[model samples]
Target: MASIFSRIVAGEIPSYKVAEDDRHYAFLDISPVAAGHTLVIPKREVDYIFDLSDEEYADLQLFAKKVAGAIKKAVPCKRVGVAVMGLEVPHAHIHLVPINREADMNFFGEHLSMQPEEMASMAASIAAAME
Candidate 1:
């Protein structure tokens, strides 16, 4: 069975797309810790981060760095925090979270919910910033 991340990449599941390249895809988290929490995943579905090839691993980080830059520009934050806890989904992924305080990146912290329209708008802004 394909993981949810694969489904999103395949367009079987819709996402608030932030940016994409031939090898990776980036989009906003529906259950975000902050206003601009985003997820970046490889196009090829691997169950663990360490399972990716050396080139794949390097490329993923490079792609994530670009997305994080866009997130910082689109959303107000002191820095963009990066996390790799490969337990939620059965696919290799990274979290790029916008944070002003250290506590903002708390994995166990409460998540924020925005309406569909708000999410769509935020995604557009982030995507634009990536350009």
Candidate 2:
């Protein structure tokens, strides 16, 4: 069975996509830690981020950097924080969160419940801000 991330990439699942390239996909986190919080993942499924090949790891980071830049522009925050906790889903992924303080990136804390319209608007803004 495909991981949920893979299903999103394949269009079997809906996502508020922020950006994408041939090798990567960036989308909003449904249970976001903050507004404009996004998840970046490889189109190819890998259980662990470290398990990815050196080249794959480098490319993923580069793709994430672009997404982070866009997120910073689209979201109101001091900086965009990066986190790599891969336990939530089987697929390896990175979280790019807009944060004004260190505590804003807390993954264990309560997540924001964003309406569909809000998520759609945020995703569109981030995608437009992409370089």
Candidate 3:
């Protein structure tokens, strides 16, 4: 079965895309801990992050770094926190969270409800900053 991230990458579902290259895709999280929370995933549907080949794993990390840099430029944050909690979704992914404090990276916190327009604006801002 295709994981949800694969579905989004395949256009089976829509996403607020922040950035993408041939191997990876970055998009805003619909249920976000913070305003600029983004999920970066490999285009390949590998179930676990560590299970990926050496080159694939390195590419994912480098891809995530690029996304985090763009996010820091776009959002107001002290820094971008990287988290890889692969249990929620079967697909390998990295969460790029904008954090002013450590608590901003808390997965158990109440999520912010953002409109489609808001997500689109945030994604656009992040993409622009990447350029």
lDDT per model vs. reference = 0.95, 0.97, 0.94
Residue-wise lDDT of candidate 3 within 72-125, one digit each (tens)? 999999999999995989999999999999999999879999998999999999
The residue pairs found clashing in candidate 2 are: none
Candidate 3, residue 16: how far the Cα is off, in Å: 0.4
- Candidate 1 local accuracy as lDDT? 0.95
True-structure Cα RMSD, model 3: 0.7
Q: In model 1, where is the ten-residue run with the lowest total lDDT?
A: 105-114
Q: After aligning candidate 2 to the native by TM-score, how far in Å is the CA of 86 from where it should be?
A: 2.9
Candidate 3 ranges with C-alpha deviation above 4 Å: none
- Indicate which candidate wins on lDDT: 2
Candidate 1 residues lying further than 4 Å off, grouped into runs, are none
> TM-score for every candidate vs. truth?
0.98, 0.98, 0.98
Q: How many backbone clashes does candidate 2 have?
A: 0
lDDT of 2 by residue, 14-44 (tens): 9999999999999999999999999999999
